[model samples]
Target chain A: MTGPPDDETRDRIDDELPDGEPPEDAPDGATGDPVPVADGGFADESAEPHEPRIAFYGGKWASTVPIVFFIFWAIVQSGVLGIGDTNGLVIGALVGTILGMFLVRGDWKAYADTIFEGMTQRVAATAIVAWLWAGMFAETLQVGGFVGGLIFAADALNVGATTFPAAAFVLCGLLATGIGTGYGATVAFVTLFFPAGVLLGANPVLLFAAILSGAVFGDNLAPVSDTTIVSAVTQDADIGGVVASRFKYAILAAVPAFAAYLIMGSVLSGASLEGAAALRESATAPGLVHLISMGVVIATAVAGRHIVEAVSWGLIVAVAFNLAFGLSSVADILVFTTTSPTPAAALPFVRVGETAGVGGSLYSGAIGFFPLIVLTLLIVAMAQIMIRGGGFEAILEFLLDSVATTVRRAELTMVLGTAAINGMITINTAAEIAIAPYIARLGEKFNINGYRRANILDANTSALGYIFPWAGGVLVGYQVMVGPDGLGEQYGPEMVVNPIEVVPYVFHGWFLVIVFLLAAITGFGREYIPDRISEEVSRA
Target chain B: MSRFEKFLAGWSLRSSTPDYEPGDVIEVMVTGAEGDRAIARIGDSTLRIEGAPGDAADTRIRVAVETWDETAHRGTGTYRETVGESAF
Candidate 1:
């Protein structure tokens, strides 16, 4: 869908979009002519010139209570307290929404309904769906020995510790580009590559940052990414065209970032590490077949297939290869167990056990993201509340009226505005949805083209979401590091990189945001609507 | 355009108010409506389009440029027809 936003992209995105319905030819009472909502309003209809949905008890500013409260809770819990439990964050979000309900002036039913509406918003659904699919696919590949395959390739190439982090950045970027979800990439790399890299003596913090950097690269450039799709749809650009136009900027930032990792990988080394050659003992050449699985995903998505379809194909191929090659069995991929007496208990996947349970790569992979998914939905609902409360309008009006008086100022405002919002919201896609309308309005006022606007919007959203200490991407990787079966359990606690320590080293993210700021200031790659026509709005 | 060309589409810093000669037919999404016409704002320039449909707002349309005032960065165009609808 990100590749072209063809019918599949639009159908998947439009139906679940937060605003609920597309603007139709609603007649004006006097003129009987069609009244247009503000152009390109995707989510958060409050971005349009609309009457406030509800008046908060203490005024419109009180609309921010839920999200702001959650933010402080996230900071105190995750930052000051160093607790990265996702369920704890979900609890914080629930409490914040409850606090918000009390602040509503009118019927609390309206506030509660908004929460339901917010939870069901299309943008959040889009991301949540992608994660579910990607999680399953990645776990299957892992169980099929994809990590051992990577290590085998490294062994064959003689890529030692000095170059492992840089190598990881490239491989992780390519995998993320294929899968089209950086969160999936983060989970995969951390689960497999992180420990491998540490064994090869790469610095833990730098290796972790390099993994996140690669994710930023792919999320910004892959046509299948949710951030990429949202950007294109909101800015009136085709997905394929947006991918092509943004490549130059992504590469510009990636070039220097790759070199930094290369140089730093040599300067900093992981303490208490074994010889690099020892990793080969854990890898077998037979495991390399999963490369074909990863390639199937990339090739299918590149061929204009929907990400869901592409990943499904990859999952099937990985499962098949695992069985054919004896890399994993049916029980490893998926298994069901129950204590109840049943004739099905003798089946390979079914086991008579002490407790009812579903296990294996398929179930575990999808189940791991359950808490994160709830957190994302709650956060998006909070954003919707702010939108309905007139908070988004208040911010946009202030920026549009005063700060965006000139073309240069307007561009700067767009860049800063995107960074500011993504900085607050950890999930990049949700942040992009909330800010898309503002970018459209500001860019249109100055006649900046859709391609440029989309590139700017997505680059900042994608970059900031990984670099922050409490960002979803970082949390995903950190969770993998400390999980019961993660690096800490396998290689001791010292191998884990605290989320905050990796922030400064995510060079790609910082450079990406900086590149947009520079582009805005210098008018580099700036396009007017008349410069060139985007291929078509309804791409096939 | 070919796929390769899409990658190299915007490599330069374009002028804020680009000059367009009369007789050039360009495609642009109708940003808004004013009076009886659709308005397309391109950077610092604005083109007033006549014969745009009543529901022309936010639609893709082809327009034949008729008059250009470089000093004011304004122009007038005759709307050809509706070309496409928004993807969303």
Candidate 2:
């Protein structure tokens, strides 16, 4: 398949060849290959390359345009714009789009086409499939009582209250990785883990912090995650390469973050689960069948399966387990698929309804990723138009000439550029999708290993999103903290840890930033080699 | 070595091409254990050694390799290398 033209090819086409000595294999002559049109002759028909006129749009000033709208919406939705909570992002985006129409001086036709192109590319398709499967698997498992089972198991372990935060963090991290969405992870933890932590008398702030940190860890590291998919695809790297490359950095920040939560929990709570013994005695250990469903999802993801296939298989396995074990009837599973009071109903697990047989819970996990799917396609279409219109040419040319001259600076630029984009968007997955094309093109220019580029992009996007107060991860975690008997009630607004409150507490995010910086200066973990592809024998 | 093996052995494993020259002072935004900070310096590749997980940092820190291996972790924080001058 034809991919982006490489540097050597593009340069040769620019006609900067010295004298009459065009290099061998150059596209300069003869009957073997199509020749370029001479300076004075022939219609310039190199496939009518749809090279749109060069012009700048107000929308091209992404940082300025997107950021203002995001901030305005954030303030509004966050109650800074008004006293009531209402979705503000849609209004913000609408304003941005309208502003683009007025401020951008480019061809209106090109802009209109760009909308279609941006929203229906391969990048968007991949994201849609990945999210859908992830949603289905996570929802199915939730229905099966996977999360409740996790709590029961944790309770059974008789952990000290001080350490419960750490344990809970680990579990949530696993859940996010398995499910593939930091936002979903946040939601799961708030509904399932948060209430449980409060009942056990754990330090509410620490508990909330633990959940946020865990979600970030999984979002940064998971192979199926939107950020991971975007970072890899944009960099022209494979998913495995990205996941593997970033593993070191994620773990580097994660381990300490986990320990810090544990330490904080210990210091703040100064005790074990208040009713651990009694809860363990009374809490029926949900059937191990539920655990099997969760295991199927995590194991398949780690096994290097494509996320959709892995999650699909996981759903089937979960359903089978539910019915086979008599844990849930078919009808019960179906009812659980839409909306369940219990978070596990969101997972693949089936539970007995008030009266029904087995069925899958929100079993259409793939459908849940529809928003991201649409967002990705739209972003890609927009990116293509930008590319077609030379929106990227000026910036790319400058970056290629300047940063490309220095290896360390280039690496640093990539990390920071990705981080800045995500910081503005406040959504890791969507940010990854929008900025992927540039990131990939930049890496190829410098011969940066796809894996390294992908890793840096994903790590930075993950880190920056959580550190920003307007981020979904932060917002959802904040919501969980304000509920009755939550962090807000325990510590008041002073200790309640809003998005702003938790930004400073995001130690993992800070650690990641430091690691990348040191790597650039010292060139310690840099990988200069590309993975080799095997040659296949020509078919007869 | 076989042709493929030899080629693989000689290949540069570093992610980016070695484009920076010695003594070229450059500014970089460093992020990791210490958080986001910028540093500038004239690079001296000879003295900039790659760091191990438990290794003590004398002046420079190691960057992560492109390959994702569990051993690449240097504590619970990322380590980076840069010339020690502040950019901002």
Candidate 3:
């Protein structure tokens, strides 16, 4: 007869167990003490080691005030004021953090430490690291003339005005999915495809919407996507499983979206093709070689390689392709030259040179995400404070007890809850991290599959993030449209598609949300992994 | 399961019936207590396990199916072994 194991015995047992799979006899769940699974460890954000009491606020409500304030401020700043600046969001978040300090009931030191801990949490850092790698890889692809290659392909295909939008939709979706960043795809398509589409006499609004719809599709399915990563990591699901399980839903929505784009493209074709020849003349065949680079990333990721390894391979291939094909100069791919004796120039990499600033697409691409990375860290910190303060618990309790009683209702809550949070939050990835724990908890209550939970979470997040005018994805795309480097020079300010104008035309995003809602109600695409735990899926 | 059956299965909630059969392998977590019989949750339905190793409460383990009753929405299984901690 084996007695209850001692601490030493337990330690030995723990060491013998597989990396992510805990021993079969370990105490877990509602009855026994919850054992943390390494792969998709259920780090109950609201149940951290910190003392729950706040210094001055009344219970959990006061502790939750900061999160509520931030949400309200976000809505007012981005949604109402239409100032979709990351700097402004940073300010709002900073102010909210300060206010949270005031509400804490404990020693100021402890509160400060909590804030620091939240800022540097592994979950937040993991996403940021992935973003940096993704940004660099995406920028590398862009520098390798991936967009030019796409244009070349479109031109070679000789797609008519009636078919261009639908074709563009497919191409952009493929590009975004390969690159794992919808925002990058949006900017690329809006800059390259938009002008070409207009030259071919396609309706600009429909074209713009089609581009955004493609972005939505990619964000929903891309294995390297930030939202996909957050949804998977937060729900303790594997990226591979999340990507696979979501295929059905993505395809279901995409078929309709593709048809809609084709139908709209035919009906809305009005351009006279006055400058189509010139646009076609500028497109080079060599640019299309980057498609192979995109293919490498997709194949590597599907083969279960680490995301970093996969993207790194893609980046290397893209850079090599650029150099070998003479698509872009080495200097243009990565320039360190800077003009004027500024503080930045003092740095070893940025000595005085003829160029006023960095000229390389790779340099700009990686640095472009710096503001968002900082924003993500701050938001996660704020989330940590809210979790430690018991805000998440209160919300989860209400969601599970009052709202999500049945499995179907639970799934619906997961979908709608994620959508609502994403609609309010400008940064979709941030919204995903904030609401992921709730989705995991709610889904787990009914033993919902990790892939299913991640699918539902990411699908709604991707849709809402792009469809809303104030959303970060839409705003970023709009900025590109208005920038001097984009449509402003080619077609003037009049040709720039207003973010709001494109919202109604984002048929795919709206359709995706509806499809998921229906899926939840009718139990479509819902699967359970029988005896398998979420960690297993997460590990895979 | 055939592709058609799998497609139809995705449309209905798993908890609506005791769908497991004999010799099937499943992962389950001990969710609650039911006298001497340990109650484990698989998907949305509960199963009573006889002669569970130790206290089954809260532990996740693989189980081999033995019997099930559709009307009662309950099933029985023999504990194969423990797998890991519950994800929830």
Candidate 4:
């Protein structure tokens, strides 16, 4: 009797039906049939789940692709099968592209379009602008004899040779901060200050290490830096906010490094102070006018002007100082800074000096940026193709679904990821771009603030780029140590510090990595997440 | 125009446009698409644009957009023009 519909149930069913035909109001699976989902899942009734897209070369290629080339390049360059200089980046790109062709599902034409879009668009524009201005400023300062001036300033202070490393680090930090580039600062220090330190009988390896440390400090902090820009923009934080948020961490690492350098200077070397006569003769008081140029740039930056505008103002000030102080002629400044210079005719700018003038300084600075800009564009294009073709998406999805879950782990992973990439690439700027997206997305998943993310990305990238053996900074330092006029060749190999030997001496780099790790573990800098204001206003 | 020229022009937004001399402070209906509408203040010399969405309309404005904290979120969408510069 209960098997049949009860009177209450029958009444409820009838009440639920519309006043029209019952057939029109029947359930989806009525009429002695059941509806089937398209993909056999409850949600798949209307659409399919989003599957992970694959690239032409899976991420396995990022590992093996570089190794194959490493083997080949090692054989060719070092005449050994297993041993070679780290030339893995070129190989990685080539092998990755080839592998991509096999696994990527997108049309070949889309891949081509993606490459062009990546190469010529965002990265290229940013690179060109940054390198051009940075080059100009650096060259101008050099031509203006800023480095020589710095030496003069140091010498007059009666500082002993033993204390030079500590002093150099502070000065180098300031230079990098002023110029807004760590790599540029490193190059400048190597060319000018490195030789001077060797002459002063300072430990050459220690000296080079100091220079690199200083560079890292600046790159970590400078508002105008590429890494800084990348960090802020990717994390959606204002520049000032990012800098402020990271200030405590940077200082935490920096103070210890400074102290270590001072102590090491005391223990490893003794002061052979230069006499006043020697100091006065060697030192050239950097004309007050030259410092004016730097002042203009700093003032403008602090005043919250746009970067381009600030740089332009700095350029103008530098040019004025060059002419006003009779530092260099206009023609010299122009010819030196000119791109695509032809040797057919002499430029009028060359007439003012036996060497080059302020113009040449500007020109050299601008030209130096060319290769970096090209590299940035090419790398960006390659990355874009990988992304648009589903390579990036695949990697990102895997990271999200399987790898990144907790905030602490995600932050640690980001720091380590940047360091790992930078070690291989040896180019901090390029490395930052390749890994920035993943870091940002990971932070967002955990509701991390833009400033914290930017801080971690830059600090780690800056540290790793100089510590690795294959890094450009290390190579240059090593070359200087071994060159004919270099410290090793002049005095002895004992006097010159090879980069391989100096790695152990690079205490700051090692310390920073450890500090960052500890910071991550303790979650000290992690509280700045979900920043309520823009980077500009956060600090203010 | 040449293809290259057109391409360059597209990227170089600050250049090519006629210089505007300041008269009365004017409000221009920021033109784009829906969900991204903004009103820009046109001063004598500068065209201040927003990096993000916000309430302030002086020169800079911040807009709220969904972006991952780790990656760059490029906001590309349509914004209808809400106002135009009124010529006195």
In lDDT terms, which candidate is top?
Answer: 1
The fraction of reference A/B contacts recovered in model 4 reads 0.00
Compose the digit string of candidate 3's lDDT tens values, residues A380-415: 666666655655545555555576756677788888
* Candidate 3 local lDDT, residue B3: 32
**Chain B TM for prediction 4:** 0.20
- lDDT (10s digit) by residue, model 1, range B1-88: 8999888887877666676889999877676666667787666577889998987766678899999999998899999988775433
Q: Supply candidate 4's per-residue lDDT for A428.
A: 64
Candidates ranked, most accurate by lDDT first: 1, 3, 4, 2
Q: Give the per-residue Cα lDDT of candidate 3 at A481.
A: 53
Docking class of 3: acceptable
Worst 10 residues of 3 chain B by lDDT: B1-10
TM-score for chain A in each prediction: 0.85, 0.65, 0.72, 0.66
**Model 1 clash number:** 5
Better of 1 and 4 by lDDT: 1
Native contact fraction, candidates in order? 0.45, 0.05, 0.22, 0.00
Winner on TM-score between 1 and 3 is: 1
**Which has the better DockQ: candidate 2, or candidate 3?**
3
How well is each residue in B9-77 modelled by candidate 2, as lDDT tens digits? 312235332334333332221221121221111121111212323222112233333222223211122
- For model 1, report DockQ: 0.37
lDDT of 1 by residue, A289-321 (tens): 887887898798878788788889988998999
- Measured against the true two-chain complex, the DockQ scores of the candidates, in the order shown, are 0.37, 0.04, 0.30, 0.01
- Most accurate candidate by TM-score: 1
lDDT tens digits by residue: candidate 2, A91-197: 55445544544533423554565456555555446544544454555555545555456557666777656777787778878877876766656655654566456
Model 2, C-alpha of A297: deviation from truth (Å): 1.4
